[model samples]
Target chain A: MSDKKKTGADILLDTIYKNGVDKMFGLPGGAIIPIMDAVKDHPIDFILTRHEQGASHMADGYARATGKPGVILITSGPGATNTLTGIMTAQMDSVPMVIISGQQATSNLGLDTFQEADISGMSYPIVKHSYLITDPKEIPKAINEAFFIASTGRPGPVILDIPKDVANAVIDEDYDDTIDLPGYLAKPELDIDKIKDAAQMISQAQKPIFLVGHGAIISGADKILKTIVEDMNIPITNSLLGKGCFPEEHPLNLGMPGMHGTAYANMALCECDLVVSIGSRWDDRIAASPKEFCAQAKKIHIDIDLVEINKVVKVDIGLVGDAKDVLEKLHKYLEPNDTSKWIKTVNKFRKDYPLKYKKEGKLRAQHVIEEMYNLAGSDVIYTTDVGQHQMWAAQFIKINSPRNWISSGGAGTMGFGFPSAIGAQMACPDRKVVTIVGDGSFQMTLSELSTAVVNKLPIKILLLNNRYLGMVRQWQNLFYENRLTGVDLEGNPDFLKLASAYGAKGFRIRRSSDVRKVLKEALQYNAGPCLIDAVVEQHDNVFPMVPSGANLDKMILGFPQKRKELE
Target chain B: MNNNIEKHSISLYVNNKPGVLIRTSLVFARRGYNIDSLVVSNDSNNPKFSRMNIEATGDTDTLHLMLAQLNRLVDVIHARDLSGEDILQKELSLVKLECPIEKRTELLQIAEAFSAKTIDLTENTITFQIAGSSEKLNRAETLLHGYKIKEIVRTGKVLMTRGEEATA
Candidate 1:
């Protein structure tokens, strides 16, 4: 074998290549001049986004679209801070991304230097891990480790702050140093005793229900979740965050049990004797009143994040490990059984209050969602930007697999879907990644299309053009006497034209009949990112919305027949 | 070899901060359980929330704890147990050893066989890196004693784990 000597930047770019990262989303800077110069001659394409935030969002979208960690590069201070929202969005949703920021020279680090901010400190809470490379020798290790940490279990972002001096410094040390990080070992094995105990409770319970969450997708445990649910014949209800964990059409699947969830789904949860929560933090929106959320049920909470165990509602059995792993183990302990009564009751409620949309309109948001869901199929990885579109996707999209739906669950960041889909696409290149963004949220990271074009990632973007911030407008309609505040954007770009300018395929779906045709064409392209501007009705809203502080039992049904009057 | 396990206690002085304890516990948690009575506190002498005293069982745990503790920011100031009469226990080590390609497969087999993970390897050259208590390093050195040793660097032990009622 021939020996070849390479510079730090060369090694770094080679490392990215080895990791199968074909593109990078970032803006050039002074500190990262060496890397910029190196990248010019490298195999990886550098996407120059309009802003650092846009670049980060594109990286985020790529990561969401694929399972690979999205890579974003930026300069110090303002450039670094600009990616904060995108970083926070990925962090909240647990999307894998690597944010590489150029830092001031090591010699000027603590001297209150120019273009320097405590970046590692600033991103500490939000990132999976962080590194400030002051030595050129550490660059290879840092980059390798950042990728490892970001793409691994319970995926999230990792930021590497590369100082100017370090980037320019020449290190004589060999490039193949295998980094040993003894301090950060998070391989949690399945605790057998806890599993046995949980199995016993689940086996004996009359009304056992699986409350699936984002952890199910993160842990890659959808198969295990489905097997257990099917074997035990237990009804499964997902949190809004857990929408795609199970196929919505599954016999026992109760779609999205939360604030705006079906009345029967909420009732089933309320009445169930056993609630096995997998990979889900008991967020208030899902469990409106934790004390009363599932007072009738004994919970078996399994999650990878230890901090989330017994956080709000205390669980009878708290097995802390990756949900996917734990579920794989738990499947063995369960005996084939039946829960027909529970299934019948849930089905009855499901039939009575089935998800409905008012027809006889010019265009309905639900129609777009159904068409999109059908066009992409269950195998597609879907991401949604916050607003009415997100809720509509939750209701309409029948996600049959894990890691299928990436959204801003906790923070509800609007501009999140577009960028996170970019991140997802980069991570899982084999599957089609489609991001559903509203007219308002799409504008937030709309500049990221340039990155998509540069990288040549085929991420289908479905912009649900409502021409208004639907969620805020809904809130205003319900509470503020329909007083629309700054919820309206007067002049929005023609999305088709915008996509074309970025060198992408674009389509505009105005009539209801055109939805499926346009969506099918978008998904089938398989060449590069495609944008479908879905001109949905402006006044459409996400119904079954339980007003904040209102009881989950009480929700605003879209139609009179859809509302359940519980005695 | 298991007879060498004479429940040793080595307190590691470290920085008290969020995720610090987890960081310290992770090293031992990776290999197997190492720590016995791990205690942490703000040093009275340095009231800026500085020290941590980690006591571990088994010589391997003590050595591994010592090396792992040194990497932490708070532990940067000083880390050691207070043993009487200056036994001169310096806890710094860097080894750049070579195992012949002919014997390389066997030597590396011995290295990895003995938990000596490789750091870097070239066609004719290979680097083995390990950080732990001096005794563990000495044992590691003995295990690879037959290999051609190229270079060895050591950082002196600052102090030893304190005894009953000792401050971190």
Candidate 2:
């Protein structure tokens, strides 16, 4: 430390390395050449992505899969602006990510020099925090603080806008590893009285339901949550981001609740006497009409972020602290309860409202997902893009492990699937990672296929080749009186040839019966990436949908499974 | 707007750095709270921090959440809404109004009742200095509304914890 002089770029890499980051995703540009040149000396693998947006999404995917902060490096102006969608996706879902965008030299700032942009200003609303390191000496502290802020509390994206001059400047001072954030409270002390209050409410309620969210996985409360649910005999539901927190195969789990959520889950939420939301802020999707989301239930919210409490809907008890800490405390006070009647009622609702499709008709996205699950099993990680395919994957695929289901829940970014799967595969090389995407969404960032091929990432792609933007078309079909506008994808290129162009294997299936055989072959191709273009029914719409401004009880259950034709 | 939708006096103690003030105000702007007035000064006991006072109007429904968001900023050390508390809040306003020879007597009488001091006197304009709560200042301005008001500069509220609890 005493013998060598270190430049700001070196210090940035050094500090991030000390914080346990080994890989980053980004593209090179003029303003970032100084840092790009310094990367050769560092141990971090710079996974150069095809587009800056892809880099950001890949990093987000990596972070979500591993529960660690993903790092990104790119240039200023267009480079920084391109990552906005990815950053907002991470921000909405609370994934941990750090981004470094190079700026013009300090002398050229505000003068609109080449590649100059106000990144910090542009990203203020989305980023958890940001640092403008015009001074070289601030590199270490800013890097360390960015990592700390992005990985703690309600994790999100943070950015560092470093000018080229600062990145080139050298310093000889030593950097110590002490974080001094006076106001950012990462771990709030447990409020025992509130936990006891929630526990007492749980004990007295005959009909109780749990709605766990992404925070449950973030806090590693899966095992404790499972134990609590089993002992209390409570039915449970999850948010889209909370898909893997509770095993979907468990009998007590009632699946997701919201606009396209399972009918039984929404009905249980409507009928429950007590609803405990563990580490979840009831977003608009979960409580679209907040006033009537659970008008009949006593709501208790347990979350680490104090701001999220009472933000969307008022709760009877708001416990502010880490989910794991509060759950452990509440577990001790919980007593066994007899909820046989309540359980039986919810089970009946589940049976009567089972999710279905025209089983004997054309191939559907849900069938492809189920066949993929049958072939890949619960061990493989599945990522999905936005729109119909995403909801279909969520409704059909049942992942048994936490951190195995990743998607853009809040932001609904369409091009998030392929790049994120590449990231997940890179992060977990031994495990299988597959992307269930639609034709419209897949073409949004098909350029990333080269990224996977160049990196030799063995990720699989299950393209639901439905020739239209199915979700929007469905809305037009139902609400807009069939006047579909700009929803067609007739110009999409041949996906199998597209995969072959990128040096990967591709397969196609036209019949529902071929789904299993094709998926088995695609899942077994371990040498490189595989793409399965499953031609699904074009007009199928997700059911049990609570339309905007409608309550959970107003679900439009699909064409009431035509009372079976008499023999 | 609801019954609680009224003006709120918020005080923030933050690092006296280049970008802290913008970050502080961004929170209000993003939350859709209208800022009526804002004042920033670097007279805090701690040199590393600056004091900011903002008079904004919004319902109390998400006010606490707004404060939490402000406190989450990197440069903000602490933030509080001192409204509805027995706190000593003061602001200074210099109001320059038309003062013709015929209106001088009436202006003097009105200034005396409001306890406003004459800060400047020109041939055509008289400027009065008023210091007190925002409500008092508003009332004083209403009395001089008949006169042609030329210009006014106000230092938004400065809050001090009334008894012994430290403001910071």
DockQ of each: 0.02, 0.68
Prediction RMSDs, each to the true structure: 16.2, 2.8
- Highest DockQ: which candidate? 2
Kept native contacts, fraction for each prediction? 0.00, 0.63
lDDT of 1 by residue, A234-339 (tens): 9988887787678777978888877767677777887789999888888888876666768777999988765566656778999988887788888888775567
Across residues A238-299, which tens digit of lDDT does each residue of candidate 2 receive? 98988888899999988888989999999999999999999878988779888888999999
Worst 10 residues of 2 chain A by lDDT: A558-567
The candidates' interface RMSDs, in order, read: 9.9, 1.5
The local lDDT score (0 to 100) that residue A347 gets in candidate 2 is: 98
Stretches of model 2 off by over 4 angstroms after superposition = A1-4, A560-567, B1-3
Instruction: List ranges where model 1 is wrong by over 4 Å.
Output: A1-6, A14-22, A43-45, A110-114, A174-182, A425-431, A454-459, A500-506, A513-530, A559-567, B1-168
